[model samples]
Target chain A: MSELTDFLNSSGLANLDWRAAVMVAVGLLFIFLAISRDMEPYELLPIGLGVIIANLPLTGMTIFSDNLSGHQESGIFGIVFHYGLSFWNLLPPIIFLGIGAMTDFSPVIANPRTLLLGGAAQLGIFVAFWGALATGLFDIEEAATIGIIGGADGPTTIFLSARLAPEMLGITAVIAYSYMASVAFIQPPLMKLLTTENERRIVMTPPREVSRLEKLLLPPMAMILIILVVPRSAPLISMLMIGNLFRESGVVPRLANAASNELVNIATIFLMITVGTQLSADRVFDTDTIVILGLGLVAFACGTVGGLVLAKLMNLVLKEKMNPLIGSAGVSAVPMAARISHHVGQQANPRTFLLGHAMGPNVAGVIGSAVVAGVFISLLPGG
Target chain B: MTFDQDLVNQGLTLTAIGIGTAFGILIVMMLLIQLMGWLVRIPARRAARARMAADAAAAESRDKALAAVAAVSALMKSAGPLESDAAVPAKAGTRKGAEG
Candidate 1:
């Protein structure tokens, strides 16, 4: 019994930090947000649980090796951190692949102008870039990576952050995905603030039905454009388009099903654990992290407004009226942003149908945000 | 610091800044492409609408032509030199009956 007590005393539990305790509370909050608020429950729940478990005070489980001189080589969580999460930055790309497989490009094909709103919405990316640089919160690469959180694209943010600012990858990704999940709540108020009721209620004529040929052509054309314009975005964009191509090719039913299902699940598990490991108490609860979260919210708000206002301007110049509410769909939160636009539009006009049209900007937002990330990464001095 | 250390530090800083500028340019280009996409669609949408209207008109014309052809066939049948069965087949039928 005395020998066992001595062994326990020699362990690192005596050095357990207070930050670990606080992180547990934060992790629980994420769980509440996921379960109670239904905010990205699929991702946030697992990530939240992983964070809580990873941050627990030393239980000798995290320690991997011990020396006669009392030196330890690794912790249980450390093993998960190094091998499971750090090396496998594969989640973002796979998630994007799933998104691509699920997306229908028909609306964008019908009204290509929505692509412009998608691009314009990325204004926040640059805005946040300057914001990060001017504030001196982080260096150029890290700042650019963090600023991509404004694009509301988790995969792009993760890809860029992993490449440019690997250390900041964890928080940046979390902030990006969290804001995207909650963007529904954040965007509606901003949309209401910018446009009048008339603009919101304006019912535009329905877009023409898109053809199968156009549907097949769109993802490839979009991929080609990305390859020519910004090679850096090709990884995420190409994979996305390929996933979509698999779905549209009609001959590859098995590949499409796999890309959208098992492949996504496997990638997500790795990604969530890796991301959760980054929330190591010491790193995430710091002053810089706090600033990153606040700035992320600002960037998201700006992107939302930028897209809507540009759309409203287009409405002014064009003969056919475009509903300004569709602009809020520019944040690239996918079905969520489109759904919010539809809901808000319906509130203004009972008969207004904006779901299909809103989808154009919604999908555009994804591509636009990625392009934005690429530009910022390319232009920044250290990036 | 040593020369090597100084070089490493400078390289790291430059890499960070390079990433930022690259990302900035990417976003700007996207905006430009978006603008061009919007402008290009105006003419295309108008042309598509025009084409649709023309197709509808063509479909209506084809229906009228088919109707005229059907009417002509019906009139020709009714206005034939031997319009009724009685006119052409009655003599044949009477001869057969007498023979039997």
Candidate 2:
């Protein structure tokens, strides 16, 4: 009887806060949504696990502690959290290395004008900036951190928020990646709302062939430009470009493999753990958290509209037809945004194939969002 | 480093420079992003086009083979066994022997 009582006491059912209970349900929903509905399991799995770990009571693992050595021994997450994230600014750049290795520059190379989509998608970032200001939720620095949600790049949002609004970093990252993961669902309806069926079905003429020399030249050229304009963005953009150069150069497969596999895997584990440590229900349950999450949804929606509208405007001026659905690809969710573009185009015309074409703006959005992050950090105070 | 900090501390001039520098890099990355599209898109687009062309060619060849087979089948059906049997070697030999 005592053994049975002890087992029950140790179970997850015991000593649970109602809020923690609710969060555990949310965690289960994340798992369900990921497996049953096939919604971005790569990110949601870690985030769901984070939520569960954070909600469990009396673990005493995440809290800081002192050891018998008389030197302070931090929590499981504390050592890396302080040294890796809080002080060093390490996670974001290293994560970019993996992203770079995975990205193929060929789509962007074929349609240089797609850079405009990147620029247009940034409209949401600035709008969120003003929105945060008007709401009085934060000062300019913290406002800048929250506004980066419109950037649609998760790592950059985490990096900037950690630096500028360490307190809000957990909520900001959750909102950013959640919206990014949902981009496929949210973007399609938003895309249809903004674009006519004919506009959605517009078929672009095939582009001409590109050369090996051009692919080799692109990353360095981009880096030089990024460094010259926004030095702060240089770290993230430089690492991304270097990763790209390594992939295209054909000689650096070893480096490319390492960046994409080993380095990215280790950084992701660390970043996710540190990110999980921040999800103390006390931090996430505040009014400010609600506002940030709401604003993040708004930012993502507006960015979708902003890209589509800009494409329509360009179509009016240019002789060539631009499928407004492809414009929705101008958010930095990478191939997911492109896939959504393809899916929406197919719904309009079964014969239409837009995946390859949408990729141009899809990759452009990555650069565009990064540039916006640089702009916000530079214009706003608190760095 | 302290001297640089002192210069930055001097006024808005350094700040403006910093802002300008940020914008400058943005413009360059923006350009590079476009250039990458141009570089990548052309080849990808061409490959897609070539693939479509190949598919069309294969489809046309398939149709032609089907049409040829149908034509042969139809001719055989319309002609009937009488014409076919008359053309056989035994009948042909019988006809030649009769003439001889």
Candidate 3:
């Protein structure tokens, strides 16, 4: 009888708590969604694994302690979370490096006006900022990080949260990624509500061909110009542009291929899993994280609205009419937001193609958000 | 974390600065991109125009050469019998003169 009682007390099953079980369930749900629905399988799968592993009690992996000589010691996940995330803030920027290599700037190069639409999409960030402040659950720096979820770039979300509100990194970054994956479902209704039937039917001519000179000139020019204006944006923008330059230089196919494929893949697995591990029950169950979760959808919606409104406004001023659906792509979700615009346009006119046009703003949104983040870092206290 | 009047004021102010700078940079980028496009296109446009002019001149010269060839061919066809008769008399006269 004594041996049986001792064995029961020492077992993993004995340490299970309701909160840990719930978090594990959440992680399992993420894994299921990723596998069955084919929604961001690369990201969600690893993140789910991290969440499940972190939530299990008595795993000894949660250990983060100081040794006798004042050296810090921890498990693998803890080491990564401390050094890769809060301690150094390295992973998100490395991910940005890959993003740059994968991106094509030709769309924005073809039509520079779409850059304004990308700028406009940033209004959602401001709107969400106000919403965050109004809730009385967050302070100014935390609010900035929360507002960035509207930017719809997961890496940017992680980058900003790492600086402003390190505790909220998991919630905000995960929400941002969630919004990015659901762009197809969430954006169409808002896009339709904002624009009339005529606007939806408006067909965009194919973008003009951009010169090789323009493509080559762009990364350097943009990198120099943006970094000069907002010095804080240098690290992220520089990495992004350098990667793009490698892609465009044609002399460095090996470097470009490596950055886009191997470097990005490795960084992505680490970053996503790190973010998921941050969502352990103790950190995620607080009032602030819950409030952020509720407000995440709204913030993202505001960004879409901002883009659509700006496109509509630009049409009013310019001679050529643009499909407002493309404006929603200004939320920095890259090809996802751009595809949503194209999909919605297809509904009104099956033959109308807005993908190329929307790509201009889609890419511009990435720059815009990075710029906004730089501005926030400079202005906010945390940086 | 609790919010206060100071926080609200800060939020509003940050919103203005943040949005203004983002839009400002983007708007400036848009302008600079246009400027870059215009600048790059100048040399290209000049080259295109020069090429077009060269093509036009070449086409004109070709047409003139073709027209001159056509005119000579027409003259040869229309005065063929006359030239042939004249050529025969001239050749006989040259032969007589040489004998005398």
Q: Which candidate leads the pack in DockQ?
A: 3
- DockQ computed for model 3 against the true two-chain complex using alpha carbons: 0.45
Residues A1-383, candidate 2: write the lDDT tens digits.
99999988987678787888777777778778768877767666676777777788866556554456745445666666666666777988899988888888776676665666766676666667656766766766776777789878888888788777777777788788888889977888899888888888788776546578777888899887776766777768888999888888999899999999999989888787567657777787788888888788878887788889988998998888878788788777888888898899989987778787778777777776676566555655655
Q: Write the per-residue lDDT of candidate 1 for residues B7-64, one digit (tens) a residue.
A: 3454345435434433344344445444545565677889999999999999999999
Chain A alone, TM-score for each of the models?
0.91, 0.92, 0.96
Candidate with maximal TM-score: 3
Two-way lDDT contest, 1 vs 3, winner: 3
Query: Which regions in candidate 2 have their CA more than 4 angstroms from the true location?
Result: A1-15, A64-72, B1-100
lDDT of each candidate versus the true structure: 0.75, 0.75, 0.88
Residue range with the least summed lDDT across 10 consecutive positions in model 3 chain A: A64-73
Candidate 2 backbone clash number: 24
Docking quality of model 2: it rates as incorrect
Checking candidate 3 for backbone clashes, the offending pairs are none
lDDT of 1 at A289: 89
Docking class of 3: acceptable
**Stretch of 10 with least lDDT, candidate 1 chain A:** A58-67
Q: Using alpha carbons, what is the TM-score of model 1?
A: 0.77
